[model samples]
Target: MPNCHCFWSHIWNISGGVGEMGANMNSIIEEERVRGGVFKDINPEDEDQQPTVIESLCMNCYENGSTRLLFTKIPFFKEIIISSFTCPHCNWTNTEIQSAGRIQEQGVLYTLQVKTKEDMNREVVKSDSASTRIPQLDFEIPAFTQKGSLSTIEGLLDRAVAGLEQDQPIRKATDPAVAEKIEEFIERLKKLKKVEEEFTLIIDDPSGNSFIENPSAPQKDTALTVTHYKRTPEHNAVLGIEEEEDDRKPVNDLDTMRNEVLVFNTNCPECNAPANTNMKLVQIPHFKEVIIMATNCDSCRHRTNEVKSGGATEELGTRITLHLTDPSDMSRDLLKSETCSVLIPELEFELGMAALGGKFTTLEGLLKDIKDLIVSKNPFMCGDSSTADRAGKLELFGQKIDKIIAGEMDVHVILDDPAGNSYLQNVYAPDPDPEMKIEKYTRTFEQNEDLGLNDMKTEGYAEK
Candidate 1:
């Protein structure tokens, strides 16, 4: 029998088996990223010493919020007009046909459609003429790209609030009518504050053919025209910064930083009454690297600090078996028949032969029989019917009758839930086995209540 055992092991050292350690390792990597918050892989300060011209990253520069300046030898009128700017961020393309005299005066049009990437695709001369034709040429420019904004803590919180509001239901969790009223209230609140910022580039094409070279000195060559546009935050809150506020915090003020530190009150082991404690001075096992500060209330002297972890298991340490079967009167013949191919939707199974005392010839044959049984019966069984139990025997049977035609077959499926602890195995399957014994621990019910001052709370939960 071929053995392919994939399990998660808490390795003391970094060296781990190829497939075995993958899932666990990924969890560790994700945890680090979250704790560190947003990180920039490239150093922004060291950009000056790097090469100025980049070919593959022309469109990418504008998309990433960087300005590109270009300079090239002109063919006509002391300076030739370039067609457009391609935004690497949003793929917005733009064109600015400047009269060499205008570019030197405006220092390159930072705003507007003609100078922006979008205007490049728009037709310039709305003419029914046969003589005028467009010209295309290449020019070189010095260009540089840099990230525009670094988000602050307040900005992150504001974004999180926006996200929360989107997922909020229109109706109350308990009362449908109340939920609708709350939703309406939220809509009104949105319109009143108008917290969201909008940015737009406007371009005017006079003669139509508007081509512009890079305006910034950094990227004069390849950073010429941007063809795409990316949505940018007009005002992003900078971290480690503070802003003046009114008596109450504004609804749309995502950039406002909070000055007060977060404080949590909990029961303390020694005394529970608003006492501050630090995690740095404690010693603990598996969670030594995790830092948590604890405090107690001044009145009760209760202390608590160990926050519960929230994530799916980094290591399931369990193996799940999936079985497929097919059975046809010409089963042996069908085994050789490659015409009908079985497709397991939403499932990928690892197959093996001789799992049960070598009862069947090929792995595929056994699976076909099982599938056949399933088709006949709404839910087929895995061979576990053993009266004189040595080990529960796997058994499956199927029957189908149409008019004078009758078809019947049997197949079996058996599995071991790693530690005999996976009680909710069927719930995890995309479409679980119907015959498998399962128990429910919760009943369905509903209720409605209202608190004064428009305060409300509603919840729903399920269990197996």
Candidate 2:
């Protein structure tokens, strides 16, 4: 085991690590970094950031190898275990990451477009619990089918090719016809790696821990789309969320409690203490019913609220464009659904739907939130002097938003929601608002695919 021991000392030993490992620790991050939009616990390295090593059997050769495990907390997120094993006899290696704590509050879906050669190099974090799909190929890798990977988009394709090719010899020996068809499909998969055609890569994670690197951060990238939504019952079941009997489940007595606040016992997200969450179903005058949730934690003095559309996703997408021409427009109440995206062409700004999370707020309040989220809280604009050009651009954008709030700027506020659940107030009441135009358009095939409707069979599924 002398070779095995030396190889591990080159990798697992932080105390007396090789120069290559030390160089990695000192490497500077060159990517354009932005803070505030992302919430991550860096888990800074300290004197005791070391892995526990143990001797284990290698899966490849059944020979003894050293396995190392490190338990790290993402904080407010879950505890995660990073484990790696290396076999000396076969020169084999295995690495995996596992969630050791609670599942996220909502599920996340990421859609990335691979249009160029550089796009294939983008990093991706594919959690074991996440599902991967490519719409063009009609290929799907179901959840838990593969170990969690810390790799680039190219690595994912390479792994897929390897898995398919591994069983080809057996398939050819037993069933040549089936093997021929598979071989053709395998060639198609290989051609995809050439970037000859543009394709979509999707990762759907019920646990909300998977991510595709956003090479352009703080600014929107046209090729990437991320959406977060409340997990469905089936998704919850898969995540082990619905298995436990809990009082936090939605109240079963909705009919009798309609117009009354229904309170549920839950834990505070911030403090992990006992708390009460109140939910009420309210009908908007021109819009559908929406559920409002408010939470209060006496132990930690933390209070928060969020809105959720009470209706199902509509058959078509809704696009509402409101021209701001008067100061009164700022007072209009707006319901921004979790699946809604907001855009202002005048400001050159757009807000995507992911984690858009339901918002019951006034036009003025929403504008202020946009300002605070992008400009006021931006790390580059706050104190980073190196990115003065980037900061100047953000500061100018904030000023224009302020002008719009004051009615000095006339801009078109567009809400494009595929779920068709958002609404903007009409001060004219019974009469049509002259300044607002609403359109309902059919969702495209791609939109339906992104929303998981392509695989859904809602009607006559039992008969099949």
Candidate 3:
């Protein structure tokens, strides 16, 4: 029987019919592992079980609504989208947490992080992860007792004190860490003052705007009283004391100041090639209004706004008065909407006339509004020949308009032509009577004699 069993087992192995047997052995091993609580394989009966998915919540304890949310799944790890989160109530976002990965078949998953929250006088930090938010951690900021003035901490005390006169020195006494030193100095001063009356020189830092009121005065301990003294011309004008003028470094046109140029590129609704659009505005100083301008592509005539935040140092005076001007600055109201209209009533015009249009009001105000619009557009027109021509024509018109405003020339009124003949004609009107032009006379200098020199030798020789 034993020989027969061995023969049957050898036949089964040789025929490759031992699949279930090996699986059964693995199952037994897995069972043993499960009994030891270390098994991770799924049973045949539990094959329908799905991986767990969890949604990450904001770690901020005091507030809700985060732009970041992560969907994590166990079993098979995966990742999804990373997006911005903002609180609906306070519009505050949890910048600490970020979307790390996404779980398969589940929602997006985000990485956990710590966040800061301020309550009354305390700031709290909390660590949180997807599906689990931890308690806020309590911490304290150590108070400093170092003795120094505000300028000292700001690294300007030495330079400021150096500029003060010897008779009047600027002294700064900060916290009580230097209390003993201050007391010793005070005692020495008192003794010296008793020996020499009026010999006590009170030193003050002219450059230092703050003052240390009574270092030993307990009643005014909490009170940080500071006196700001303006730099007087008389004080700075003293002999041998040259007030150092701040050397303002020259600013680069392209690099200086803060100006952001955003080029919005899109195809023209009409022609789908390349289109640049922007709406730029000059933040006029002390003015509540902004100027808007736009430009269009030359190829397709596709119009769009070009915006630029360019900083100009030019001084813009207030629009204090607006009265009647000339007809040079007036223009027809072409605005499609009343909201786009900027014509003010009883304002001056470029033509040295008051704007009394068919319906519009002041043309100067309207011109200003147009200027604002043009600036807002900041349109980067194509460098095509056609665009260049258009830009040239526009520039010519601008020059002519400026001349008209300066009362140097008049804007010739002409019928509109599709060929842009009117712009050219208005831009360049040749003098009809060229022959009637005035000619400037010049002295026919006969070498040095034509200079009209009153030489004594020449006069005597001529008389002789």
In candidate 1, what are the lDDT values of residues 19-128, reduced to their tens digit? Answer: 11112323433543464521222222433312111122233342332222121112211222122233445555332222322221111112222223332322221111
For model 2, the stretches where C-alpha displacement exceeds 4 angstroms are 1-51, 70-80, 243-252, 255-464
What would you estimate as the lDDT of candidate 1? Answer: 0.28
CA lDDT of every candidate:
0.28, 0.77, 0.29
**Tens-digit per-residue lDDT, 63-180, candidate 2:** 7777665554432234555567777788777777666445778888999989998899776768888999999999999998988865679989998989989999999999999999
Cα deviation at 196, candidate 1, in Å, is 44
lDDT of 1 at 364: 42
TM-score of 3: 0.20
Q: Report the lDDT tens digits of candidate 3 across residue range 1-464.
A: 12323322321221100011112324433444455422233332443322211223333434444332122211121121112344455444422211232211221211112111111111111112111111221111111111112111112212222323222322334434455544454454344323332221121333221122222234432222323345455434421236455454434333322254445676666777777765433343322223234546768776643222232211211111222234533442211111111222322222211121111223434444344333333263333433666667555545544444454553332211111101111111244322112112222233113222323253457563
Cα error of candidate 2 at position 290, Å: 20
> Candidate 1, which segments miss by more than 4 Å at Cα?
1-227, 233-314, 319-350, 353-413, 416-464
In model 3, what is the error at residue 126, expressed in angstroms? 21
lDDT value, candidate 3, whole model: 0.29
Model 2 accuracy (lDDT, Cα): 0.77
lDDT of 2 at 337: 87
